[model samples]
Target: MTITTAPAGVSLRGVGRAFGDHVVLRDIDLDIAPGEVVALLGASGCGKSTLLRMVGGLDTATSGTVRVDGHDVTGIDPRCAVVFQEPRLLPWRTLAGNVALGLPRDLPRNQRDSESRQWLGEVELQGFADHRPRQVSGGMAQRTALARALARKPGVLLLDEPFAALDALTRLRMQDLVEDVQRRSGTTVILVTHDVDEALKLADRVVLLGGAPTGVSVVLDVPGDRPRDHHQPELAALRSELLAGLGVPRRTPLERETHAR
Candidate 1:
């Protein structure tokens, strides 16, 4: 049987979320097109993750609506899959077994196993399928986590700082892997990340969330071909702009020279 892809668009209107006395997000409005990759960029405690959770139906808004493909989602939407910062794999389960957990219950055990193994291969963890989560390296474990999310063929993939815990090299590798997979699958993705460079490198549009009762402070369109170079002048300029938007101070040339000395 051929697997069908279902990439859904997301819409949020006048959305607000509060925890008791404190409000995290307020009057936020955003729209994401099907197959578009959007990064929610912000500093820590800026409510980017909260906004993403609302889109995924994992959290309810105190005010306004969250829609997926024109339908309002109330609880955990089957159309969405989330990969968090930590791998969060069950230690006792093999990598393939964890991936199989994402498959539909209607699928036969044999088919689930086959599909799980296929997804493992897609994430370059086919050889580790039989290995328990404890047996794999951190990067390998996160790869397995990503495969688990993709195996379900979710219409929308939500990533909450999925690479924040990885080393620099491994993080770059995982970012490349995600770009390749999303390009092939054309799944709509909302990635919540504090890393400005990571957001600019991966997203078609980068939305900055900041300020008290945080909402979008800036929305930048990143127009270019795939596999963007971090050292490119355009990206570097955008990076500086993003950092400034997030209240980061940019050092002057003289200050840089002094610091170097």
Candidate 2:
């Protein structure tokens, strides 16, 4: 496992999104340092996915800017890759085939094969190279999906609850695999998760997205230490803090208007 450090610094300025009359996000301002993993935490309908989409260039913000490592990604850039909740692999393709998809066909055959094999091994799926997506277990399939993302060696990785569909034990193993891989590769990661423990275990900073328009509700910095054990006392405390933040009651629009007056 060659631990290649990733450039993770990110800045968002006046970022917002809306669908017709529905404003899902409003005036989001955040800065994530290089090599940092920031967890976007929120309840369902809080626009966490919308925010991540804007960052990943899958969806454009209705307004404002999203910059990764100082470059705006209003469109997909070769510098970043996204791994969605489902494995989303082609049933006809083998594991190596899926990863090889990340490379340009313009590259020579030998080079592509080498790159694909290296990335698959990096993701700990070396033995499953010839298996089709359906032939592998859920965890193994996800490993291939992850390998596909990393084969390109992107500066940033966007994960949208990639392990949500797995069973509890598989999810835990995937979580550990992610931590180990990210630590070794140093890829800047932005994860959208509803699980507090998941966020606490992996994020350098956790930004809670809430409010009717989905404003940044709270930003909690996990303070224990690098590669912090998820079972540690301080990390557990931080998870409690996040849960408490989520439990904060939201006031009605009329109440907010009244208070403003």
Local distance difference test values of all predictions, in order? 0.89, 0.84
Misplaced by over 4 Å in model 1 are 1-4, 251-261
- C-alpha displacement of 149 in model 1, angstroms? 0.6
Q: Encode model 1's per-residue lDDT on 80-172: one tens digit a residue.
A: 989989999999899999998888889987898889999899999879889999999999999999999998798999999999999999999
Query: What would the per-residue lDDT of candidate 2 be over residues 131-249, giving only the tens digit for each residue?
Result: 89999899888888888888767688888989989999999888888888888888898999998888888898999988889899899898766566777856655666677778744
Pairs with backbone N, CA or C atoms under 3 Å apart (clashes), candidate 1: none
Residue 255's lDDT within candidate 1 is 53
Q: Model 1 lDDT vs. the true structure?
A: 0.89
Tell me the number of clashing residue pairs for each predicted model: 0, 2
